[model samples]
Target: MLSPNSVYTSKKLGHYIVTILTIIAGSTVVATQINLGNRYRGFTITQLISSYNIFCSIILTSQFVCSVLELWSRFRTLNGQLLESLSCVGRPGLSQLLLGWRKRGNGEDLAARLRRLQHVHLVLQRAAELLQAHVSPAVTFHLMYSVVGIIYGSYELLVVSQAQNRAESMIISPSTSYSLCWLVHHLFDLVALTVSCSILEDEEMQASVLLRRAVGIEETVPQVEAFLRQIKRGPAICFTASGLLPIDRRLLVSAVSAATTYLIVLGQFGLR
Candidate 1:
């Protein structure tokens, strides 16, 4: 069983992380909105309104990212507990090599452990369901916008590096502060997404390892094998972005690499 105090503490920690990320996102977004508004002052009111709408939409997206991070943390805690519970079942489902193991009432222990494992499995399934529900609605738009934003950030960074090389220095100004804040926000977003997804993938593998060990036990417990076949029959429980792609460390690396590629293409083409 999971301790209530520990779960609450984990939740609190997640909230703190979410709060900090939100602050970073909100501040950068506000500055961006202000800057754009000034640049388009002569534009029609409808155009200005549309620009602000885009800003608000992205700010909401950052909030969703925070929520997803929290869900990932919670699932990680549940999976860890499940792994520990499986370890308690002991090896080979018996204490000794003696033939009368079942006759000595070890069956009861096996039965109880099997039940406990079932309960943990259900908890894990529910956690996945909850995460999917939250992710499904936004998954389509989320990836597209995130990729574009990160690509743009990478391009800006490249431009700044080249400018510094030519001038031997850079100056601090409002625009520079805005660029720095945007870079920080994007970098923080990347780390949060990568860590959570990687943790989720690790837990998925651990669950399979635990199930494999349970299958090897000599005990004829039907539930144990049934559970294994159910979970591993199709796929291990890992986070997916709207069933389009699985989110993991690989996704993180791929996103960054793709962004870099786009940055190079845009640079060579000279935006001329």
Candidate 2:
């Protein structure tokens, strides 16, 4: 469905360019930090994790973006094919006017269209399986790094802010600026990931709705019911992080709540 046409070409090109630029930026930042002895020169554990927080955030964000793109590409194709298949419903008028009514064996034409729909459904199911399998591990890594980054980064920022409040004059260091940017990057990364999974869920819901329509059309075809029944029996394509966390807006809300709670607890205990 997404062939090398203008719409597809332009969209793909833009995403690729952005991804490349992000990769270069992340790599350059890490290299600079190491060369400037910001972390690599007999770094303490805190400094090491601090460095890792940025590096992992970048890596995981890129992986999530790529995975989301791939999944979206497949689902878009599925949606297009689904529309084509739906045309077989002969909802009257448009399809008949375009191709003209078949004067020959009408049953054969209907059967062929039904078969095409079945084939497309099979392809969609296969794609959904592959997408889930490929992205699950990456999602798990993203979630893990996200939790660590949020908690640790928030602690660092809170302590620094408090110190600055007590100081007569605030002096900003390169590391401090980098840390601030790092925290912002984590926020962006989390939002990006949350949106990506939400889109996947939406696509799956679209497919389900299409199948339900097919079930409705079963009144006429009677045969499409078999195919629809098969699909309906299986679980819908649900994206989860390492089979534990469901990727949804609820996950995003809960993660924020949990992070905030922990940060407060850490502050109370005088995390140093």
List where candidate 1 sits over 4 angstroms from the true fold: 33-109, 160-174, 217-222
Predicted candidate 2 versus true structure: per-residue lDDT over 1-272, tens digit per residue: 45445347446744774575376446545644653455346545655555666566566666666666566666666655555555566544544444233331234465566566567657766776777787688768877677666666676666666665532232222344555555555656676677677876687567566656655544666555665676678676667887897877777788788779987987787534
Candidate 1 residue lDDT tens string, 1-272: 55566467556756766676768766776666665556555445644564465455555545555555544455555545544444434453342232112222233455556566566666666766686677665654655556666776666666555554432133222354456666666656655655666665675566566666655643465766776776676455666777787766777788889988898896777333
Least accurate stretch of 10 residues (summed lDDT) in model 2? 166-175
Write down the TM-score of every candidate: 0.68, 0.69
By TM-score, how accurate is candidate 1?
Answer: 0.68
* Backbone clash count for every predicted candidate, in the order shown: 0, 0
For residue 206, model 2's alpha carbon misses the true position, in angstroms, by 0.9
lDDT assessment of candidate 1: 0.58
Error of 2 at 81 (Å): 2.7
